[model samples]
Each structure stands twice: as C-alpha cells, then as structure tokens.
Target: MIGIENIIFLIVAALGIGLFVWQIRKIRKNVLLGRDVELADNPSERINKTLLVAFGQQKMFKRMLPAVLHLFVYVGFIVINIEVLEILIDGIFGTHRVLGFVGPLYSGLMALNEILAALVIIACVMFLWRRNVTKVPRLATGVEMRAWPKVDANIILVVEIVLMLALFVFNIADMKRVLLAGEEVVGLYPVSQFFVDIFGEDPEQLYIIAKVGWWFHILGILAFMNYLPSSKHFHIIMAFPNVYYSKLLPKGKFTTNPAITHEIKAMLDPSYQPPAPEVDAEGNPVMQRFGAKDVEDLTWKQLMDSYTCTECGRCTSVCPANLTGKLLSPRKIIMDTRDRMEEKGEHPAIFAPNHYKELGVERVETTDEKTLLRGYITPEELWACTTCNACVESCPVNIDQVSTIMDLRRYLVLEESAAPASLNAMFTNIENNGAPWAFPASDRFNWADELYVPSKN
Candidate 1:
C-alpha cells in the first residue's frame, strides 16, 4: 500500500537517524576515554537539581531579557515537535492530516502550534540582533567566539527562523487547498490564516506550495538533529545528565589525592602499609600519575562537562581572573578540553588499536605530540585562578570549571614541582614550621601576647 513518495521518505528518515546514532556513539566513546569516578550518591537530590537547572531554567533567570526570550524559543521548540509526530505518521502511510481525526482536540493543538511558531520566529530574530547588532559582551567576546563559534550561533538562529516560516507557509497553503476542495478546514490556523490569500485559489499551485513547505520543515528538523553533535547546541541533549552528575560538595572543598594521603598516613604511622598498585591484564603494574596531564587523566564526568558546555560565557563573564586582565577564561578552559578530546578522537589508532586494525590501516605514530596541558592550556592560566567558584556558580548547566583548574594545578605542583616561587616558600614553611609563616609554632601566639589575660581560678 506504500506509494513511491512514502518509500523515499522511509529511506531518507533511516539515513538521517542512522547517521545521528553513529555520531552519538562516537561521542560516547570519546567521553568514556577519561578515568572513572563515582558520582552515584544522593539520587533524589540529583534528580531535583536536574529538574530545576535543566528543565526549569532556574539559573538562566539571572539575566531577565535573554531568559524570557530563550524561554519562548525553548518552550516553542519542544512543544512544536509534537506536531512532527503527526507529520511522520502521515509521511509513512501517505495519508493527509491523519491526526485531524481527533476533531476539536486537533484544532486546539494546531492553534497552539501556530502561535508558538510565531513566537519562536520573533525570539530567534531578537537573538540574532543581539549577537550581530548589539554584540552582547558575554556572547560576542572571547577568542573562542571569533571564528566558527560565531558563525555557528548565527547559522542556528537563521535556520530556526526559516523553519518557523516554512511551518506557517505550509499551514496557510494547506488551508487554501482545503477551502478550494469545498471541505471544512481540519485544524485552526490563527497565525497562518492571515497569509492564506497569498497563494491564489488555484488548486495545483496551493498543493505544490504546501508540499514544498512540509518537506522543508521536516527535512530541516532531521538536519538539525544531525548538526547538534558538532554544534554547541548539543547542550540541549547533554545538559540534563551533566546537571544530574554535578558536584554536590561545598565549592571551597578540594579533592585530595589518595596517593598523597596514603604517604602522609605512612609517615605518621610506621605500621601502616599502602595498597598495592593496580595491574594491567598482562600482570604489568600500571604507573599512576598524580594529577591530570591530559584528557585521559580526567574523570568521565569532567569530560562530559566539556561536551555539555553551552558556550554561553556566563562562567567567563563572572571569572575574577579574566576580569582582572589575567590570561584565564573558564570558558576557554572547557573549550580547550573539548578540542583536545576531538583531536584525540580523530586518531583511532591512538585510542583503539583493535578498531584501527579492523580497518586495515597501517599503525603509524601521530606527528602531533601536543598535550592538553602545555599545548591547549597554559601554566599561567591555571595558576591565575583564585579558586573563587564564581565560574561554577554562574554556569547555567552546573559545569565545574574550577575543579578542572585545581586538577591541572595539582599536576604542576605534585608531578612537575612547578609551583610558583612564592607558593614554594609557603610549602617549605608549612613542612618545617607547621604553618605558612617562617616562624616556629611556639611563637604563633606572640601577636596576642600584649592583650593576653590568663584565666585565674
């Protein structure tokens, strides 16, 4: 019972969905390349946080105007997708307005969709103006925003505008077609009704226009789905899980290295013995590094944070180090992490030998020997952080930018002994004098000696 058009639709849909799945799998593999860390505690709290931050857009309200506009676009994008389901059903079976059978309910849904589509168009236009004309500092500034990132934002906004317009054109033309046939229009077209007369009463012309608009809208959705992985808009899918797995501890609390803790314990108690080093599958002991020198050294959640970044620049805008004319930008740090991951991901032989062998390609050493530490992020940037957690608090998606900064600092201090000269002096004082001061512990109370009054019983 399938027509040629229905068969072609099936083929195109399969190709589009299959390509998206493949890219998603590749991204999943890249994220899992990092070391594992347990984040399975406090399930109920995690869910509530996810709902508030991701679904409720709680953090986005800090800026009122953009938040309101974003809400229109966000809600409209999601709610309008319900109509896509009906489109899919019609496309597969070669039926016309199949959901129109729902009678009054269908009319109500169509009316709502029309209004939302109009709102989305307006919101997207305003967003485009902000980016191009007004040049919002957070959205426009940043070395990362200069080239492709800038173009990508504009492209998405323009695409959204075109898609909404296509929806209106499709509705208006279809209404005209129904009227020409002397049949009652199935769905209400509040927004589209004004444009219904644009396409003359010619039956053939209305049918062609309607078909073009419908095809353009649906095809645009599929293309947009595939584009998400490569675009910053991937946050739409990654934000929920990223927020759920966010760090729950106090911002000032830093995670200490277990290897260092074990060493300290051994120094205090001679009877204490540290655990044995982990071995590989071949029984060779794995050499563990102290801190993250590369993406593989970071936790899986940290890598996920990289991909989940919305590039909204909220973190960078609030970064004290950046505001004070320092080389550090928290947004740049996260973007660098993602860039490194993508660089490594491109070379399958570097990560997966088995897969590379299956492809019948010769295993060759990569010419680029750059690492995430020196190549992507500089030492100056890592040391500039005040550890204020301003970036973490400002992030709409709960990305822990400070944690990554701390981990990089740990690598420099513990592994390379590369802490700045001032910090080295403090470390020596703490080791020898039990404090950050050069004086002995016995003289610590000397400052209060003048005002001291011993308790007399």
Candidate 2:
C-alpha cells in the first residue's frame, strides 16, 4: 500500500524535475538561435581537455588559495550528493536508512559525507571573505559585477553553507534517535556528535528534528538544480561541456571568416571559383551575415561561453587595454552577450525586427529596438582590445573573450563600414600598399635600412 508521504514526495520530485527540464530546453533554444559552428574535429582531444580542465580544475590552480578552497566545495558538492540518492529512494518508498544495509561501508560513506559537508561550509565562508573582506581587485567593482551578479555570488555561497549545515543537523538528530531507541549508532558522526548532546535523548523530538532537516536539505538540492539555469552558477553544469568544446587551436590564433577568406582567394587567383550560395531546407539561398552584430549572429559556442562565464573578472583583470584605462572589460563583453541574449529572449523584438522583416525574414520589426553592438556593448569597448590573448590565458573556464570582441569588430568594419578614421586609413593602406603604413610597397625595405649591422662584424 502507498502512503501519503510517498505520494507527496513523488509529486514534488516530479514538479522539480519538470521545471528543470523546461529550463534546460529554453537554454538550448536560446543557444541554438546563434549561427551554426562546427567544433567536432577532435574527439579524443576534447575528452582530454574536459577532464584536465573542468574535472581537474587545472586553470583554477593558478590562484592557489582560492583553488584549494574551491576544490573543497567542488569535491563536497560531488561527494555529499551521494546521500541524495538514498534520500530519493527513502522519499519514494518511505524507508529509513535503506543504504544502511551495506553495514560498515554505509557508515564509512556517511562519515565521509559529514566531513566533506563541514569542509564545504568552511570553504564557502572563506570564499565570502575573499569576495567581501579581501576585496580582490580582479573581482572588480564594475557594473558587470554589481547588481544581480554580486547578489548571486553571495547567495550561492550562503546557500552552500545552509545546505551543509542542514546535513549535519539531520545526521545529529538521527544519532539522537538511535540513542533514545537504545540502538548502537551506525555512522561515525564526528561533527554531528556534538549536536547529539545539544538535542539530548528524546527519540520523538529528535525524530521531528531529523525529518525537518532531511526535508529542507533535499528540497534545497532540488531548488538549487532549478536555480542553475538562470544564474551564472550555471557554470557548475556548463563547465564540463564548455571546456570540452574549447578552442583547441593556439590561443593567439584568430578564426578567419570563411566567407572573407573565399573572397580574398577569388581576388588573388583568377582561376578560383566561388562556391554556390548556402540554401535553406526549402532550397532558397540563405543570406548569411558576416560576423556578429547581435547575439544571434555569434556562434552557439560563443553564446554558451556567455552563460558559462563565472563573472570572476580574471579575463578583465588581465586585459591590457582595461589596465591602460580603456573602455574594454573582457568580463563585460561576456556579460553583455549574456544580458543581450536574455533580453532578446524575453522581449523578442528587442533587436531591429523591422530590419529583419525588410530583408524578407519572418520576424516583424517593433518600436523597441536594441542590439549588442550599441545597446549592451559599445564600439569603444570593442576597439579597445589589443588582441593580446591575455584574457584567454587568464580565464578559468576557457571563455574566448578576444574572439567575441573580434567578431563584433568584424561586423562593424566589414558589414557596417563603421571603422574609425585611423583604421580606415590603415585598411586602405593595406589594400593598396600591402602594408598598414601609407608608404608604397617599394618602401618596404626602408625600415631595414634604419638598422645598422656593422657592429656585429
């Protein structure tokens, strides 16, 4: 016979799962709105990258103190979740300590979980101190880290502490129940043992405490799962796949647009033939825009990178232009992309829908118009980048902020012809003289003449 508790548990679990799945679907849809990119070249290398970078937290170790603290939290999140399996089973069947049948091994696992949970609480506290007390420069006071991003970071740390505390309370109360029943305690509750003394020897009272703690802890996990899709904390889930699909080419290497490459080749070789236009499913030639003017113009991986951003500001901290007081903040570039993506998802016609309609697209233009280029990020910020790859090297999640900046620059220069006067002059010089200087190709050796090698002899 099924009990009311089991039925209620099933309903709540079903609702949580359903909501989480829906959020995942929405995120997938938003990411797919971007242009298709092929990153399927190397399978083994991808797997190795995911393991080394994501699982190993290789990049994070560059900051040793934070890395150690983060390792504790990360390991605790994985190891302590083992108890959640037992919680699920117990919830569904209305059984107590079902895994306790594994005897000493079960007790050992419980002890390990308790120790890890305590460590997680401690780590979270240190993380908060690092953010608030230490005031790390890298975790800047910019608009990117202000508002909801700031609150979200603190909330996650507080939530972890709360969850870990609940686990200890549950274990302590459970131990009290064992004492009252005159049964030998099963698990080695080292940290929770102190709690047993506080709660005292009443089985009935302890049982109530245990149930409350258990319910809160399990429900907290479910709530945390659903919260992930909407928060920067989504990196907890996205990091694995993001690192797997990371750019395998050298960090300094920039991706060339195939369309522009083809055009240049055609110019260089008279015999070169242009490829046929890309056709949609209905066989109509699809017009592809060059570079990223909006979120939808970026590659899906770039969109994914935005969501995976931890907002740590490591990229912005290392950015040479930002250090030089330029407008560019690599962190903001990613945050802006995410903000624009979410804005468009919510408002739909936030971008110039009328423009899309005039081009014969299905989307209709609306009065509310915005774009990533000017609305969320400015051309000033875009052009400030030095293309130094410092941001890429500093990123813990392998987010290629430089690539995103380059794509926006490409859209501005190639599509809109919106380059600054100096850049325009440089482009003209490159076109005519085959150099960035205004001098003719004949003057290419002029700089070499300035350097005297007679001293070497």
Candidate 3:
C-alpha cells in the first residue's frame, strides 16, 4: 500500500493541473469560436464580478424551484469535500477515520455531510425523473434535439448523467457507513439511521465497504474532471463570465434614437455607423445598427451574448410571438445565431453566396431561399416577432434576442428592401418625412398639425 501522504499529494496535484489545463484549453477554443468580450482589466474588479455572478447566483432566481434545488446541491458539494480532508489524514497514516483535535471536527462534518447528501440524492432523483419522464419542454428532448444541428446533445446528456449518478451513489455509500455503525462518533444522520434500522445488523462489513465506496467516489471524480472540457457542460466555464458580465442596463433602455438633444448640428446621413461623430443637424447619433445579417456584422460583445445562452428555452416559452402561434420563437433565433457563427467559424468573411457552396449547401447568404425558408429557421418564425423584450427580460444570461431581431429587420429593410407592407411603407415614409406617417402636416388632426409630443422638457 502506498503511503497516505504520497497518495494525497499525488491526487491533489493531478486534480489541480488537470482542471487548470483542461479549462484553459476550453476557454481558448470558445474564444476562438467568436466569444470575445472585454471584462474589466483590474484585478479587484474582476474578482468582484466573479464572486457576485458565479458564487452569488444573482440572476438564477427566475426559476425558484430549480434555483433552490441547485443551491442546496452546491452546499452539498462543500460538505462532501470535507470527507476529502479526512481521506488526506488517512493517507498520511493509513486510516481515513478522524483522529485527535480535528477528529471531532470531521466526525461532526460527516454527520452533516450525510444529512446533506441524502437531500442531494433525493433532489437528483427528482431532477432526473423530471427530465426523462416528464415532458417538460425544457427537458423533453429526444435524439433530434440540439442547440445546433452539427452539435450533438449526447455529450452533455452523458456528462450530466455521470455527474449526477456519481453523486447519488456516492451519497448512498456514505449513508450506509453512518447507519451500519451504531452510535458512531458522528451524530445522527437521520435518513441513513432510518434506512439501516429497516435492514438488520450489517456491522460485519462496515470498514471494507467504506474503503470500496471511497475508491468508487474518487474514480467518479476523476472521470468528471477529465470529461469537463469535451462536453456542452462547457457552460460550467462560460456561465461564470456570462453572469458576471451580464447587461446592467434596463431592457427598454436598449438604445435611444441617437436622441437628438443638441439644438445645432450639421451632417445627417442615414447610412452612418458612428452617428455620434456624424450626428446630423439635430445632434442625434441615429442608433445606426443597420442590423446583423451575418456573423461578422455582430459586435464582439453580441457574439459573447450568443455563446452565453443556456438553450433552456425559457425565452421561447414567454415570447408573445410563439404564444400567438406565430412561427417566431425567440429561443430559436438566439440558437440559430450561435449555429451560424459556428458554421462560419475561422472562415474569412466572404459574400455568402460564394462560401456556402463550398460547404455543400445551396444557401450561403441570409437572402437565399434555403436561409429565408429557415435553412436553420423558418420565415414564419421571422414575421411572428412582435419586437417585445419579454425574452430578454427573463433570461439570466442577458441574451439580447430583441437586438438580434432588430438587426435582421435592418437587413431586410436596408439590403433586401423586404418586410410586411405596412412596416416597409413606414420605413419609406420615415425617410421621406421626419416620422413614419408621411401625410401632409396641413391635414394633420383637423388643422394646426405642427404639434410634437416629447415626454421630457
């Protein structure tokens, strides 16, 4: 048998280095996949952001039941790791049971851990059955589901299965330990005691069982550690920044029409991108995002927003367009943007027509029939959008589906000159007159039609 201290040192070093290298490589790959956003460079600020979002779980309250369940599971994690300390002690001395000053500390911890472990196990059971048995839209997935088509959901499903099942079985073993030994130095771990009372004396194999259980426990952890990088659980890394760097501004406050506050200005070009430097006679920047028709058209931050979506479909559930039976699913919109970005990965920007043919698809650009017919999305889905921010409001990750919709709208209006007749005419009239309705001012509101309604002074 190896010395306890040597084993402890080896495992800790392995875990630390393995996790570090794996996560670093994963993050670099994701960044290469168009996830570019600059967080504050200051150390304290970065630390603060990490703590509030990743640890604090600030935005996760939207789904209270799952949020609370996940919160308890996280606490359970801290508890179970305490047993690792006991293992280290045993590694140095050849026995894992607590001894000396920290003996009581660990014993008490084992009892607490046993209790939390039971709760965690129960929650896991409920969660698993809920996902597999219940037809909840979020969890009701079959072989055909995906955040992206080429992306396989099986990778994530398998990882989640391993992680949750390991926790479940590992906890059952800990409970067995607490129950088999009567009046252990550890206090009451009710669930185990309750179960053990149901099964007659089993003290004969307690120590052997503990050793076997511990081995399985460690192996399960090793598996999880190694598998972290290659799965959709990649969110485990992305979620940290996703929350910390979430949008602080309100939903409706998305953008102002380059609010023309200044009384005097000169140039006014509708095609202008940086309208501020090129503000017209009214001092308005014109909010010139003629819309993201292609991946390159998105801002670096917007690309980050795409990767951050959890594919949970909470956004789709609340979208007015989907509810009214319109083909527009906001969740689908965010999902497709992410998909297209992946399809275009590392490829230099070229006219869509020229490049898509290289990939064995007839549709290269958004204007093509394959794309318009919803190569990845349906046209009915496009027109169903009401431009409401409900999806944006509910998302914990600040995924700006509304902005994406506006960008597509911009592409249709400015590039294809296509839209619902009313909206198309409105756009034309906006160019013809200061507002959408281009009716003569003399006929406005039955005379004296020179009235403007500005809410602020």
Candidate of highest lDDT:
1
Q: What is the Cα-based lDDT of residue 109 in candidate 3? A: 69
Q: Candidate 1, clashing residue pairs? A: none
Please estimate how well model 1 matches the true structure, expressed as its whole-model Cα lDDT: 0.86
Give candidate 1 misplaced runs (Cα > 4 Å): 346-369, 452-457
The residue-by-residue lDDT of candidate 1 on 90-192, one tens digit each, is 8899988889999999999999999998999999999999999999998998655656678778889999999999999899999999998999999899998
Cα displacement (Å) at residue 378, model 2? 0.1
Q: Model 3 over residues 198-217: C-alpha lDDT tens digits?
A: 32346445545545555555
Cα lDDT of model 3 overall?
0.56
lDDT-wise, the better of 1 and 3 is 1
By TM-score, the best candidate is 1
- Enumerate residue pairs that collide in model 2: 353-365, 354-365
Q: Can you give the TM-score per candidate against the true fold?
A: 0.92, 0.91, 0.66
**True lDDT of residue 406, candidate 3:** 71
In model 3, residue pairs whose N, Cα or C atoms come closer than 3 Å (at least 3 residues apart or on different chains), thus clashing, are 4-91, 5-91, 291-407, 327-381, 328-381, 374-377
Better of 1 and 2 by TM-score: 1
Cα deviation at 264, candidate 3, in Å, is: 15
